[model samples]
Structures are given as C-alpha cells and as structure tokens.
Target: MNRRTFILGGLGTLGVLAGGGVLFTQRPEFGRLPRGERLARLEASPHYVNGKFQNLVPVQVMNDQNGENRFVAMAKFLFGDKSHLSPKQVMLSKKTDLQTLNPAEDVVVWLGHSSFFMQLGGYRILIDPVFSPYASPLFFINKAFPGSNVYTAEEMPKIDVLAISHDHWDHLDYPTIMALKPKVKQIVCPLGVGEYFESWGFAREKLHEEDWETEIKLADDLSVHVLPSQHFSGRFLTPNPTLWCGFAFVTPQRKVYYTGDGGYGEHFKAIGQKFGGFDMMLGENGQYNMAWHAIHMLPEETAQAAEDAGAKQLLPAHGGKFALSRHPWQEPYRELTKASRDKNYKLVTPEIGQLAYIDGQKNEQFGPWWENME
Candidate 1:
C-alpha cells in the first residue's frame, strides 16, 4: 500500500474488482471519504487547494524526470525479480511485555514497519498501528514477513493517544483500528481523516483532527504537534483527499519526531530548528525506489534527514515487515549502517518489539541482527 498503484488500487485489485462489481465498494476496509462539515473543514485548510491536499513543496508521486512512468513502475513491481525482497527465514524479534513497562519510564517499541508503541511523559501513545498480517485490503497482498507481527491489538495496553499519519492501507488499517478502538482513549489524525473514524462508530469528541503546523496540547508536559511531511494519502481510488503529516511529541524534558513517510526536504531542518533539535527521530528508510523518490526517501537521504533534524538517535523504520518494494528486504539497514557513519546522530536499529529507551543517557545496544537472517 506504500506505492502509487497500491494506494490507487482500492480494496480489491483489478482482477478482484473485475468480478466483485459494485459489492466491492460496500466493504468497510475501503473507509469512508470526507463529506458534509468534515469536507468543508478540509476545504478551508490552507494546505487543501483545488480538489486535493498538497505537500508544502509540490511533489510528484512518480519521478518522471528519472525516466520512470507509472506503467513502467507497475511492470517493475509486478514482474521484477523478487528473490531478495523477503527474507527466507522468519524475522528475528523480541517479545517484550508492553503492559509490564514502568509508567514513569519513557520508551519506544517499533511494531515493525511504520507502526510504533511509545510511552512518553507517562502517556501511552500508539502511532500508525497495523497489527494485522497484511498491509493491503486483501490478505494476499503486502503480507507481513514471518515473525514480524509479534504484537496484536488484544495484547495492547490502554492507549492514551492513537495517532495516525495518513489513510494508506499499511498505516491506517481498518481491522487493526476497529480492534483497538475501544482501548484507545483519544485519536489524532490529519485533516479529513476523522471521517473514517466517525464512519467506524467512534465518537466525534474522541477524534482530534488537525492540519499541518497545529499543535494539540494533551497535557502540561506533553504536546503532540502535527507537522509537515512530503507524502500523499488515500485508501481508495481518490488520492490526497485527506492530509498527510509527520508528528512531533514534545515534553518539557524530551522531544521525539516521527516522520510518518516522506522524502527528504527542508521541513526536516525546519522541524529541527522549531524544536531546537530532537532527542530521537523515527523516520522511514525503506520501501523506497527511484521511481517514487519524490515521495519515499532512500537510505542515504534518511541519514541526511536525520542530521538535518539534529537527532541524537535515529531509528530507521518502514521495513522488516513487508516487501512493498522490490529491493532486498535488509538493504535499508545495510545501506543506512554505512550512510550514518559520518553523521552526528547514532543509528539505532532494534529488533521488532525491542525497546529503545528515550529517558536516559544510555540507549540499548543492538547489532546488525538482520545480517544473517536470509
């Protein structure tokens, strides 16, 4: 669901839709589009222009300047050699008991790919959670690698804030969201994304939707800021209807930035300067290609972005779960290990479900666990 066709593919693929007809539209996984007052609020936002929400710097979904086209990209994805795209063995991971964690401690647990469980300022925050086995509407597409889905919604602790970056199938999964709805106390999403939660029976008051650059003060010590990211959003046929964003979790003592999914841009430096630099940065460093480099970043760009954000520690995400792109599954880790050598920030690569403490002077020491896991 990270690619252009995957986003535009809708719930069903072309073959699946060719047979299902209009009944495919009835599926709840497709999610409801913004309408009524919600649509009006989206239209009023400065980011929304013409008919769609645009990035701060105008971005093309595909980089046609690199001699890439949609059809060519689609062909490469569908027919490309994918031998190394997924690990032959199950992914190595930890089984940390999230519920047993101390409330006073601040920590981050990456739930494979872009989903994360973080405890900051004594508040439990879950971002872009996809506990389901698949990232697509269908079970066959974008399936999670073996042993990658170590945590489930039922096992999750009571969530203080469930922040969603976008409406892409991988990030805003319908089944996962429905399962975690009752456990989540409050929901934070980009503009117009509240429509899906409303349609899913969540109370309007529970949803806090904000446009880019707006900050929602949750507590005296903690404030979640909706920031800019160079990405697009869509779960169905229509693209960029809802806003896509990055998030900055700020507290009096610590600061963390999560780049939901984006290419490198000045916004990284802007965010770093805005917050006086971050203690840690969780940015996307996988599922990228030259075909869509304008949207998703490469490993080298990820390192540079981390430096631009002045991050003390950089935790590379958006891999170790699914093969959304044709590159070797562990390429991001290997490339980033080298790319971050001369960078200011320490590149912290933890196994799925392992803890990355954010409160102290010392962080967990992790090795290249993906090295021999073919």
Candidate 2:
C-alpha cells in the first residue's frame, strides 16, 4: 500500500475506536445488576417471561417541515436572541422543620419539574426527585438555575419511600440517587427501573417492582397503586426497555395522583373509576409540542386529564426546571390558566419550595414565577 493510503486507513480506524469508547464509557452500565436470583423472582411474573408489555423500540427520525417543528425558530419567537434568555432561578423555601409538618395530615411541596415531597400518615415520600444541575448527557451544554439546588440532599429528612415513575434522566438522576441511597428506606418502582437501583448499590431487598394495576400497602392508611400511563421510557438510544406508569397515593386524609409523565389517554378515566375521586392531581403541563403529541399532552389536555382523573384540584408539573421543549418557559402556565378559567377547574401554581396543604380550602398562588425571570 502507498504511504498516504496506509496513513488515511489508520486514521479512520482510530476514529472508529474513539467513537466507540465515548459511547460505551459515557453511558451507565444499566443492566449489570446481580441477575440470577433477582431474575428468578422477576421471571415468575407472566409479564416478565412473555415480554408482553415490556419491549424496547428503535427511535425513528422525522423530516423537518418549514418552521412547524424547527426548535430554534420556536425558541427565538419565545425568547428573543435565545442567548439573551435569562437563566432559571431557584426559589429556596424557608427551612422546613419536620416536626411542624404533621404526618397525620397531608402536605406537598413542589421542587420544580416533577419532583415533589409529600407527608402523609407519618410517612415522608419523595417522587421523581431530580436534583442535578442539568438533565442532558453533556452537563455543561445544558444549564440549570444559577443558585444552589432548591433543596440539597443533606437537607432531606430520612425518607420512608422514594417512588420513581420512569427511567428518564430528568426523572431519575444518578447523582441524586447515590446521595439519597443511604437515607432512603425503600424504593418502589416499575418493572425495569429497579434494576437500575440494584446496579447503583441499593440493596436488592429494598427495591420493590410493581406492574401496572398492582397495589402495595405501605402502611395501614397509606397505599400506592401503580396505574397505566400513556408514555415510553429510555435513557440510552434504545427506548422503553421497561414499563412506565403513574402513581396514586391513597392516604386516610386524601387521595393524591402523581401523573409522572404521560399523554392524554382513556387510562385516566379508568383510574378515576377505580380510585373514585382524587383530592389533587399533579399532571405534566410542559415539554409538549405538535410533533410528539401522542407522547406528551398539551396544556388543554392536562386540564382534561384532571377531569378524567376525577380530581377536585389540578396542579400542573413538568415545567419550570429545564428547557425541554420549544415553547416559552411560561407558555404552559399561560395556556393552562386560560384553560382552567374556561373549564372552572381549580389550578394550583406553586412557587419552587412552597408548601401546599392538601386539606386546606385556601390554596396559594406563587407566580407567573417563570415570567419575570425571562
């Protein structure tokens, strides 16, 4: 071979090796959990053996049409000179004394995005906690709020339960989980997600896997029911390696529904029928676009979802943390407020770290918090 040809071929081979190294090392080894005994117990379930409901599908790329789905143009329209858009601000709550938060009653605090802290029946549960600065694989490229995390890991109380709705990076953060492992007593998650915790050093015994429609009694008065969500999941290139579902927290004082992240579907009606009525429904209201309508619901659909779930009050989530969609940061709130006004549904828009008491008749209004920041 000529010297120049040989040099070019060698360079190509090196490039290939470099690309493979980045792909393998950057991605977490999610399936390396101790599989023998755990797989035995998991295989006993019919869903596991048949792969009836759990399967990973390849993601399809779409052709961009005009400005219809161009994220850059949409972002420019929402925030002039995208680079000039202000960073998100974190609202720190006044120090919460656990003694003051009565566990005999019901209380909720929204920590931006879909993360929430709830106290009921003497149990403290955190749902989909993402305390990391960025949700993207490349941390520096994606920015979070400038201040400290709204709530630090050290500040958290000894948690009774940590419930995960899915395996999306924004919903399940690796840094936060490692920090919280020592303090968390048990983790209740859907089918494939428990494997992630097992690989991350959480005791296998502490992880409980529940399929759709299964109920686990946490305490005499507190129970969690895994309900269907019209959604898919994946952290790597492959999608939906496991199942995705919402959670219903049934306490003696109230019924709270955490609609993790889902599109509008008939399942909401089924949940209403099974659980009767919910005191408050926390549903996703942001990170939506026309291209992925079937995967993420629009603002109007969120209000409709609240009604379908038979919720007396609605609290929109999945916004105010990261810029996951083309819409302006405040667009969801603006549209949802109008929808709530037209439909006569009570909407709760809490500031970051604001406490919301479920039993109280007077609900607090925090913002348009995302508005002024922009």
Maximum-lDDT candidate: 1
lDDT of each: 0.90, 0.75
The 10 consecutive residues of candidate 1 with the worst lDDT sum are 7-16
lDDT of 2 at 199: 76
In model 2, residue pairs whose N, Cα or C atoms come closer than 3 Å (at least 3 residues apart or on different chains), thus clashing, are: none
Q: Estimate each model's TM-score.
A: 0.93, 0.84
Error of 1 at 38 (Å): 1.0
lDDT (Cα, tens digit) per residue for candidate 2, span 1-374: 99999999999999999998767655663333325665555566544435323422222222244655556645544555444322545443433554467666678888778888888667899999888888755665345655425777767888998999988878888888888888999888987788888778788778877888899787798799987787777776554556688999997778999998877878888899999979888889998866666668899999988988888888889987676666777789889988887564578887777777776575666556555565
Model 2 residue-pair collision total:
0
* Candidate 1 ranges with C-alpha deviation above 4 Å: 1-19, 65-68
lDDT of 1 by residue, 38-130 (tens): 999999999999989999999788766357678888777768887899999988998789999998888999899999999998999999999
